[model samples]
Target chain A: MNALPAHVDIREVGPRDGFQNEPETISTAAKIDLINRLARTGLRRIEVASFVRPDVIPQLSDGVEVLQGIDVPDDVSLMVLVPNSKGLDNALRIRETFSEVAIFVSASETHNKRNVNRTIAESMADNEIIAKRIVAEDLRCAAVIATSYGCPFEGTVPLRHTLDIAEQFAAAGAVEIGFGDTTGMANPAYVGEFFTAALERLPGVEVTAHFHNTRGQGLANAYAALQVGCTSFESSFGELGGCPVPAGSTGNIASEDLISMFHEMGVATGVDLDAVIDAARAAQTVLGRKLTSHSIIAGPIDWSPTADAPSCR
Target chain B: MNALPAHVDIREVGPRDGFQNEPETISTAAKIDLINRLARTGLRRIEVASFVRPDVIPQLSDGVEVLQGIDVPDDVSLMVLVPNSKGLDNALRIRETFSEVAIFVSASETHNKRNVNRTIAESMADNEIIAKRIVAEDLRCAAVIATSYGCPFEGTVPLRHTLDIAEQFAAAGAVEIGFGDTTGMANPAYVGEFFTAALERLPGVEVTAHFHNTRGQGLANAYAALQVGCTSFESSFGELGGCPVPAGSTGNIASEDLISMFHEMGVATGVDLDAVIDAARAAQTVLGRKLTSHSIIAGPIDWSPTADAPSCR
Candidate 1:
């Protein structure tokens, strides 16, 4: 097997992606508190909130308020998701407050159209304009290709199709591109080959691999991507954010879970695992529910045989 | 990364290990029914029961009855776990009934003493004698070195200790050796390196990788083992068995989850995914509780977009 990367960048997406799909509406104060706690956990990049239509995602309607509330560490790059010109305008109004803004379009037309009520072409056009504006505003712009691995509506997205969209995003001057397995449909072999091809094709652009634990292959897929040299990852705290349509689909691979795996493998993710677990615990409290994160449930494997048993209650 | 193996041998251990850890005792008939269903799922080797003391693991107290009750297929090899000479004697009473009997010792002395109330040296001696007796009876003998990666009691076992046990097992005429992460403390890098070294040292022995999902790296570790060419795996149906001492530790990597991963990677395991799911579903029915198996919950990612939505409920 190939050697694993020495270090990986873990992009926290819980505040936005996770809360957006939560059944209960988390208060803006709770969201800000979680984001601030996450920032303290050595997470350098955090997708704090999404500036989508309030009616569509009422959970994140307080995006601007959340952005205004949190005290982001100077070293942390706070990112927010923007859907169109309106969202971008909202983000640009406070462009100096955040470090990065991301725009997304699903890899398959069906999913893109369904998600954003816009065709992939129209979304890309909007992204092109948004990407330029964000870059011009001195913020790092990221174009996330959602459902890049496989589409819920269109299974097994062709590699070429995703690459074509990525090429467009790259040309649009997006500095980073994230490929999201929006519905957790990616397998290890596919992840390995896809990331290998993606990095090879999109040289110099920061390539991030995003996976969900829906089928429980999230960490496995992350390992595959790591083996193929994709160093950036996006995960949610407490394993929040499943596919809305597929009601019970699991959330993004738990940020703490992914960090635990990397930390155990001696891969430096910069994110503090203990702190991440604390954040996850706080999230469970805030969400008023138990979380799916393995680390939060099981704790990091106590490597000290002489230590007291982990209280697994 | 190296190419995954073309085929893998999945040894089903749910009947023995899984039941032993369950809170309630499964009826003999129910156990037999599940075993029969699992046999139909293309699993060649199934550990049907363990001949441990009934009081110690009341859930699997029906070992003898289960062994006599189930219908054995012509192609399937029924295996059972035997802890000592007494357990081996009990298994030997039905010697013709099983194809294989396994003895186990923990890699770490603390864990070994804690788990079996015996030192590693004593367990090894006992295994050597039991292995000879089993081989004398023309039955395959397997030595399981538990906590080969890290022990809950004596964390991070040395590679030499596990290798020594494996060598002793091979020297004792045992044909297969399984390295178990009893506490789910193994990471992928360690798994790859350990298995790679194991296969090298024990050149002709069938090396098996067993993992628990306690910290959720089970499938990832399996992937690592596969990368290093260990093609045999031991897993539980419905993710049934966990470290009994560690109150909330999860069961062995769910058999269905591991099978799903291998199948998705195009590595054939001969196990029928649908049949395995059916068996898992049936297990949940018999257990009267929700299972931890990922594929059981989410179903396999349907590759055909036109397929009907999975009834996740």
Candidate 2:
């Protein structure tokens, strides 16, 4: 019942986060093609690839090639993920090519250690230095606090811990911050309160909400954040990047699904729903499997007055 | 954010709506088993079967047998769908078994013609007589106004038209009315506004929201209804009853998915989460296929502090 936002910013993470979790390796050219198609869909921001260790995540091994091969429009911002200083070094090598680079650390100590083999303090120290370097280099940077909503190992993360980390990231010269529901444990009530607290704690900062559809609350949580005045969001095309541990869990919220919801609610996202579905279809073909996206599966609600009646399934 | 309702009434319609949509017909015993499991899951109201023409919905041809087979508890109310006078006659044979009977008509004339070979006016005329009969028989009656949100054939149903239909149903001695998103076209904004108007116009009527997950807005729309103080909802276990007219379209909001969302937000449904999931699993086994409910697949989000971290899918 809150007044909805007039518009929202959608950041496509399919090319990077979506492809990285696939069991099969994606070619640089295929990744470039997907990203290029996505860019044309009126998505102004797309995370192209991650600069993680190739041995660790071979799916996104060709990060540099993907960034260089894709022909992004001037208006679209190409983002690359940087894990630590080494990843930052790789990103900085082609600093001018990417519009921004993101560094991530888990809110839970266990998840951070399991994900990156580093303690929270150690990751923070690395991020502080890397974030400062990226700011100094004049490139846009964001500190992504993963598992900001709830952690698999740690459960309900202390609100203080997440906010404290955001403050540190802001202090380290990070212009933007991202709170991730890395495991898809966020609820709408929690999301509304969390983002409200986040925005109040760090004013004048571009905060992004990244949610997964693992538990099917991704879009619901996104709406809650939007109600609380968090305008930017991160999602994947075709609902890619499904979590492996929870065998049947889905990945990020589909870009088309989120856009469709916003567009239906009279909230502008400046993204083409049909075009995003095209990209999602393209991704599905590349993967040789079906992806989990409701909008893509069920096309936009036909508003034509004389259309054929729907059948009873 | 709006304050969610403190409690919600969940009407489990899987035994009727869900199974009727499946291409394969389930055995009468299997239907009884699934219904029995659901009845024990703390679902106070369960739509056990539909008394439609056997030729039309052959999967639910065992309606009478299923009604006679299941052992419902004292606290549970067993509901059955009756299509016409004949269906009601069949239900009246064992009126003592069913606590309530629901008669349905589509908001769109085209859908009504296709679904039951009658115009909205003809159906309404029939419903008025049938509703009075059911009330006289000491059974609660509900007029299910299908496609109350948007008609697949007509599209964008006027709010005035829907409320007018609700007014008619309430005037016909129908104690309860259900507004169905037959093709999953209802948006949260429209839903909130629609329900607000429905309650105001039809004061003291037990209004229920019935949604399909065709475009994945079922739960989201349910949440919107909740925000507007509509606490009663109808969902199917394992998200059964998928729409066949729309290719690749999903079914109703999974009972577990809606319950999971409400439970997470500190709302009470009185139904056991794990028990509902168990019934969903049992339904999946009976159907011999995977279901669309996220809770059935992902299990509940583990809040244990020392639980194993989720894997990357």
Per-candidate local distance difference test? 0.86, 0.85
Residues A160-226, model 1: lDDT tens digits = 8999999999999998999988777888988888988999999889999988887778899999899
What are the runs in model 2 whose C-alpha is more than 4 Å off? B311-313
Tens digits of lDDT, candidate 2, A195-303 = 9999999998999999887666777788778878999999888988845447877868888888888888899999989999999999999999988898888877777
Q: Candidate 2: deviation at residue B236, Å?
A: 0.7
DockQ of each: 0.50, 0.63
TM-score of chain B of each: 0.96, 0.97
Query: What lDDT tens digits, residue by residue, belong to model 2 across residues B11-116?
Result: 9998888888888999999999999999999999999888888888899888889988899899999999998899999989988888999988888878888888
Please state the Cα-based DockQ of model 2 relative to the true two-chain complex. Answer: 0.63
Chain B TM for prediction 2: 0.97
Angstrom error at residue A3, model 1 = 2.9
